[model samples]
Target: MRIALFFALILFHFSSISQSTDERAIREVLAQQVECWNEGDLECFMEGYWKSEQLVFIGSKGLTYGWQQTLDNYKKRYPDKSAMGILSFELIIVEPLSEDFWTVIGKWNLKLNSDNPNGHFSLIFRRLGDEWVIVSDHSS
Candidate 1:
């Protein structure tokens, strides 16, 4: 019984470490996205998202489905570097839903020459293979 308890503690320790690592990785992805956006590289910005047809995004306009569609929408909305602006994020919560899924709640801001647009976002990230990517996003 003592041996079993020891093994369980070991497993719990490793799980906690793994969870912390995963959370850091997710935060890095978001940071990279912000860097890409600030550089006015939409393609690079999209790299943080799941490149799948099942990906979903909800914005001020409405709900958009698919990776290509979302990229297209971004391109159309922010046509130039001036419109893309400098992006930043303030994360509120990063909660693990399961071993391979997480939910993030945050606020995003875009500072442009004329105006700064800011909004709150909730994102669902999934571990697709070895990398974590945003599978669903709802921003307003």
Candidate 2:
């Protein structure tokens, strides 16, 4: 019985450590994304997403499939620095779906000289090797 209890404690400790690490990683990924946007590098900001054909993005226009198409849409919509402006995210929730997946809900805003656009977003990130990349995104 004591042996079982000891193993349980170890497992709990490991799980707690992993949760903490994942939280930090998620924050870092978000920060990097914001930094890329602030620098007006849409391509760099897209690095946070899964670069696969099966990646999905949903917006007011409907669903867009493929990573390249998503990037293209962003490029078309933002156009220039005036459109991209400075970006910020207010994280509402970041929950682990599993050991290798996380779901994030947040508010995103772009601050521009003439206008500030704000929207809510839901993102799902999958652990790909050592990195966490967004596999699916829905923003409105």
Candidate 3:
């Protein structure tokens, strides 16, 4: 019984450490995206997303698949720096779905061309090897 208890304690400690590390990485990924967007670098902003054809993005228009397609849509929507504007996010929730998956909810606010456009977003991230990449995004 003591051996089992000792093993259980070790398992719990390992899980706690893993979760903290994952949360930090995920936060960094989201922060990098905001920084890239604020710098008017749409291409860099896309780095936070999974660079796969299977990746999905849902925006005001509709659903778009593939990294290049999503980048194209962003470029089309925000043609210039004035359009892209300053981007900020209010993270509401960051919950783990599994060991390698997480779901994040946040509010995105953009200050652009005299318009303050704000909306809610829900993002799903998957650990691809080491780093986390957003697999699916839904923003309104």
lDDT over C-alpha atoms for residue 3 of model 3: 100
Model 2 C-alpha lDDT per residue in residues 62-124, reported as the tens digit of each score? 999999999999999999877899999999999999999999999999899999989999999
Q: Candidate 3 lDDT, tens digit per residue, 17-134?
A: 9999999999999999999998889999999999999999998888999999999999999997778999999999998999899999999999877889999999999999999999
TM-score of 1: 0.97
Model 2: what TM-score? 0.96
The alpha-carbon deviation from the true structure for residue 135 of candidate 2, after best TM-score superposition, in angstroms, is 0.3
Per-model TM against the reference: 0.97, 0.96, 0.97
The whole-model C-alpha lDDT of candidate 2 against the native structure comes to: 0.94
Residue 42 C-alpha lDDT in model 1: 92
Off by over 4 Å in 1: none
Error of 3 at 67 (Å): 0.5
Q: What is the lDDT of residue 72 in candidate 1?
A: 96
Error of 3 at 31 (Å): 0.4
Ranking by lDDT: 1, 3, 2
